[model samples]
Target: MAGTTGGAAATAPGKKGETPAATRSGALKRLPLALLVFFAALLYSQIQPPPSKVPGAPGGPPVTAPRTRLRDGRHLAYLESGVPKEEARYKIIFVHGFDCCRYDVLNVSQGLLQELGIYLLSFDRPGYAESDAHPARTEKSIALDIAELADNLQLGPKFHLIGFSMGGEIMWSCLKYIPHRLAGVAILAPVGNYWWSGFPADVVEEAWYVQFPQDQRAVWVAHHLPWLTHWWNTQNLFHSSSVKGKNPIILSKEDTALSQKFLDRTYKEQVRQLGEHDSLHRDMMVGFGKWGWSPLEMENPFAGAGDEVKVHLWHGVEDLFVPVQLSRYISKKLPWVIYHELPTAGHLFPAADGMPDVIVRSLLLGDE
Candidate 1:
């Protein structure tokens, strides 16, 4: 091969009437192109996007469907599944996670909801899905939205609550403010509050170190500089939360597939156009902010319920998004929370097939 290449090179210079100087000139000309390619690749590999400016739409287009009006005049778009309100033997409210809306309910079977007489309602939080944005939304205020939503619909004196991921983190607010109105509560694979002072140093260290560096920065920014939450998530020059990425805060292949439905292109563009202040950013700001109390400081919320009011906490053993160690610490501190630590599951465990039935049944029908 070497002899053949040398013969071709010799023939090309002689037969083509090309001078040695010309050949050298051609080689020199190609050198800069190669360098340009190398440098372009180097820069491409190093460059990254910036965090958003205050965090915009959390995705899913504004709801075009008729929306229910809360007393405060803000509107919420919701989806209802299973039995009608009156025929419902079990009325449950599902709080969706970050970057999702009313459409992203659990993978529960219609047969199960019908057979069990379960009426599940999922709604968009203010500032998402055409739900009127609440400029002054706080942790307590958002929780009140849930209570008022129930009251407006007249969902009787009490209803069951199921919160997934970010939904689960804020579920604490409901436990704090509206425990009397809850028949039961199920928190699934909740996003842990790393800034919560209740966690031990070792537990916090273990969980914080396991997170992807970008997510660590995201948490750090959200906790320390709440004002920069949007920019920290949307800027084009730095790493941000996986919330808007291909693999959100999930760890399993099953969860990966579950996330695609939320990360659709058309869905993203639709919501991005609204340019509303995002409820999810508020979730991050309040989620890591000083809540004045911690779940570790919580008494059994169901302690005084006249009827059976079970509080179930389901977490995945393999969950790295929020780490099982933190959940373990929480369960230990609040022993009344019935902890279900599933083996080999990840952050999106709540979306697994047949899991919804399991969670609801455990919450209402007892742990049969």
Candidate 2:
């Protein structure tokens, strides 16, 4: 200003001897604020809340079985419903599908119990909600776990098993390793072994999840880099088609509503716990990997044992997640399986109105 220069002369770096000390002082004054911001970000990253629950989520009624400590030093959580009377027709164990917990089958159990008076025991698979993770779990190991669970609950030598979707793999394992402990097996829209040949090319192409980009990526990760599968699941970076294929095969409006209800219930249960991704990843690995045994290689437990230990396979011809072709392949390999292919059903056929009654009547009560 004395030389009539612009205002920059006063603030310009090193112009009027604005020293490094001034800059240092300025940074020092900001140190506390900087530290506060850094720590705030660190805490936010570490303590982020879980995703919000889905609106109108169909939560199951209160759980009954409660958690029990298994002999292997792991916790097994389960829900028991229906009449537990000694004269109950069948003590059925319900194994839920992929990405689902024990509560997924509650509605089905309620329907069966109300109509047929069957006893139902639905347990969370290892690595699922409230149950301890089994990092090294194999199909055979799961079968043994079921046997131990039965023994712990004192369900006697044999009990009926109902496996839905991915749960069917465990049912197959039981057929292979613990046939003597099973009264019967029922699989609904079960995923087939990847190594099993005869998947129709057209069917595979039509299944939406098979072609969906996210699902393809997830499946690739699940097969090759299984350790990343859990992260992938937790990120919600995948999609599985809820409908049949490109088209809808639902029978009525009520069936459609019921399917939505089941899907909502399943979604709520999946996010109810922290380690659901672990179960999901484990399921994918076991399904895509070498199943401990094959139905083709194993002897039919009901070969000469009458209808007590029969295997029943129920699938919708339009199933997208597990194509009916897979079920057909299984039936061909194990010709003794009682296979039913509903023409107008889809992947959610089990949850369709009145289907639960049909399943219970046919599988547990031995009705035609």
Candidate 3:
């Protein structure tokens, strides 16, 4: 009887079954909560202002330079600093790194500027702030834009270039495309090419983020959902104190204070424009993606002119973001790069006390 079913079993409800009404009731009970959450998220998104749109917000410094039209009709915003009359001496055009704008280099000490006797220029690369997005922008295309900007500003036939962090990629492109236009090139804590071989054994070991997905989630988001990347950066503003915790040894008291001042002025200002997100997205995409050219393909432009264009590579030995070994590899590959590996320094050292002066002076004023 227990094992077998009677004729009545055929008409009975299936074993362990709940009535259809009960299932429908359960879904109905959960519906209100789901709707509540949906509407809450919708409201938050609607009311929350974009990071760039907020007034007196924390980001980069405000745009102080006039926006000029390039040959392609896109607007290129730039800041010109230093003695305008000193233009006869080689000009310095600064290329900013991730999350930075033209204002990044504006904080260089007044004493240093007066001492160097060099004209300084910095501009928003395509898409970072006020600069128009170039959807087809490659590293070489960016070089072309710089060439156009150089011509527009009448910066002579050549100028010294300083590329910081991710900006180094564009600097590499400049070397390939417009070497003749450069008086010298300097890279500070530059991002290394992924395709380059002979990476130090410790590179993979030291670069824990490369192995850990959670650590690199922000970068992943920047590559996939740039809007979210902008929102995250906006919500979590940069503070020099943040660096203090992570890099205790790298920043001295003077360096920390200078860094704080620099961040206070430039961080919020860099992201004030709506186009910043687009620019940041493009930078990440082009930086990690195929560069469309190789550093090996480039020849020293000054070689033919009977002079060697100075190449300076400065990297902090303790840099966790970009391994120092990469710089070592790059120096070896290029052979001509004058590499400076600071033992007590980290990635942020370039922006630290006396370092900016050192960088500008070493290139402009020479070792003297």
Candidate 2 ranges with C-alpha deviation above 4 Å: 1-65, 106-116, 197-213, 231-256, 263-272
Per-residue lDDT of 195 in model 3: 46
Cα lDDT of model 1 by residue, 64-111, tens digit: 655778888878778888899999999999988876777777767898
Worst 10 residues of 3 by lDDT: 238-247
Tens-digit per-residue lDDT, 138-160, candidate 2: 87888888888888888888898
Residue 90 in candidate 1, Cα distance off native in Å: 0.9
lDDT of 3: 0.67
Model 3 clash number: 11
Candidate of highest TM-score: 1
Indicate the TM-score of model 1: 0.79
* TM-score, structure 3 vs. true: 0.70
- Candidate no. 2 TM-score: 0.71
| Model 3 segments more than 4 A misplaced | 1-64, 85-87, 197-259, 266-272, 296-301, 304-308
Model 1 segments more than 4 A misplaced: 1-63, 247-250, 257-273
- Arranged by TM-score with the best first, the candidates are 1, 2, 3
